[model samples]
Target: MIKQVLKNVGITLALFILMINASAQKVTLLQQGRAVSIRGLSVVNDKVAWVSGNKGYVAVTKDAGKTWIWQQVRGFEQSDFRDIEAFSDKEALIMSSGTPALILKTTDGGANWQVKYRNRDTSVFLDAMDFHGKYGCAMSDPSNNHFVLFETTDKGNTWKAREMAKSPLARNDEAAFAASGTCLNIFDNGLIKSNSILMVTGGSVANMIQAHIDEKKWSTQQLPIAQGRSSAGAFSVATNGKNWVVVGGDYQRDTRTDSTACYSNDAGKTWKIAKVTPTFLSCVQHIDSKIYLATGTAGTYLSKDEGLTWTKIDGGSYNVCIKTQHGKLTLLAGGNGKIAMFSMK
Candidate 1:
């Protein structure tokens, strides 16, 4: 009887350990060497991914995250490429942030790049860009007290600024963050009439700017995340269907947890703070109905219940996180050229 009781206790302990391991996610470091800060990530599928960052640096991996090819756009070597939109292993577009703002496109991978747009305005700065199907748009920081919007319908071959009336004006100190290349998002509800563009702002306030693609009508809403200072506000916005999540915190004090994230089920109509929050997440992405990933200088976090709660999966610093649209591959990028692949067991 004593032997049987001991055996049963051992089995129970073993099963408990298995259950804990199964519920925990894992992060595997893939590549790290260079010192470039990687804030832009585009995972096309399980086999292809692209990332762009400061000093006009761009990296592509054709064999998932197993290998990477790094290059710097020759002439624009000094430019800080903050955002990237990738269509495949060979075609992608990159955007720069500061003065002499630029948008470049490459069709032959990173070997060659073509200038698609350039603005010498000292105040011009782009934050992020996104696309839904063939339509795409890029959001910029407020210039002349009005935020700038650029649209493209030909897969980023060309871009045109929408009229001022179509682009909304900015509030006092209201601006967007180029931290993780995810301040703007475009989505469609499988209906021609349901296409929309969503942009989140920081600085003096945290707000979401919503616009209808067909109507060009825009609306604004104040978010519940940290705000008021130039270093605080909503840094990223993401949506999967009608469910949306926004995350941000004072970048200067990245470890602070106050008002770092919120979620909305009715599009952008309302938002409620998460019961549990991650500290200073510069970027957030919805992987599926139940899984969401966020990252920042502090670390990487995963939320298994939509965005209501979160748990830290990795302590390594990162700036952005994204999942492949065609497969289950998830990747995170950050400073010093750090890149890692996430595995959920």
Candidate 2:
């Protein structure tokens, strides 16, 4: 009798272990709130998620997307949050449209956020922020004569300016960011784009620029530079480890395309025009080799071939912030303070 009991107990244990593994690897989304315009959203893992936007709005989700608790991130109430970068569930950073270049940090998940660094003197509307683990940097529009870039080694504890290595593009108030120093771009003849990683850059040089992380090794290429292309001035760029996509429009020309997108598979050496039409593209997120893009007022587009072809997933996407978790897609948009969520089929 004792031997038989032991055998049964072992069988049950094995079955339990298999069930846990299956549950942990699955991906899906759950409805947490109503549809509102969001500026930025990021998922650290299957459980932890974060979103930010104008008016100092920050939302956190601990149980994947099953539930979310809206919270106020300190520093700016009427400030517009444009970019957010996260190293882990416990640490993250945000860049906003404010004077003194607004940057916020939180060490304790999304429970609370404090102003870790701010530079009022160079305030020219901070646009984007990126990081290489804990060491990250940010770029701002050229407010003064000199363009500026901010760097922080110890997370967001402190920050300092790094002298730019000389750029030809007029500092006509541009914006830039990088996933890391290894995935950085210089907007000139420098390094070649890699197949393993996708890097994004934008501005007046949008669709007509080159980039490289390390200056020692050079990989230079050119982009599609034609006259009357509405999306000339790039606002932001993003990639999902497959294709690099840039978002910007001819703000100067009232008759501009809402969104301008271009991609290069061979690392920044050459770029090809994407098939989809973007109306004010904002950000992009990739999952399971599929690419999901977010655009302001133009809705959202999904592509499985790395921008080879795109299909509209949502109509009139007022989303400022969009992110993908597992197979779920989340967006924050609508100027009326509405946060919306969607699932990728």
Best by TM-score: 1
Q: How many backbone clashes does candidate 2 have?
A: 27
Residue 166 CA error for candidate 2 (Å)? 5.7
Off by over 4 Å in 1: 1-23
Candidate 2 residues lying further than 4 Å off, grouped into runs, are: 1-37, 143-147, 166-232, 240-242, 250-259, 290-292, 320-334
| Candidate 1, poorest ten consecutive residues by summed lDDT | 187-196
lDDT of 1 by residue, 1-345 (tens): 999999999999999986796456888899888979898899999999999989879999999889999998898879998999999999999999888888999999988999999999877789999877778888888877889988999988889998877787799899999998889988776532465878899999999988787665678999999999999999998887667899999999999888999999887789999999989999998887778989999988888777899888888999999888788999999999999998886
The per-candidate count of clashes, in order, stands at 0, 27
lDDT of each: 0.88, 0.52
Task: Report each candidate's C-alpha RMSD, comma-separated, in the order given.
Answer: 3.2, 11.8
Write model 2 residue lDDT over 139-202, tens digit each, in one string.
5555454345566768767887755553223334333422111112222212433311123334
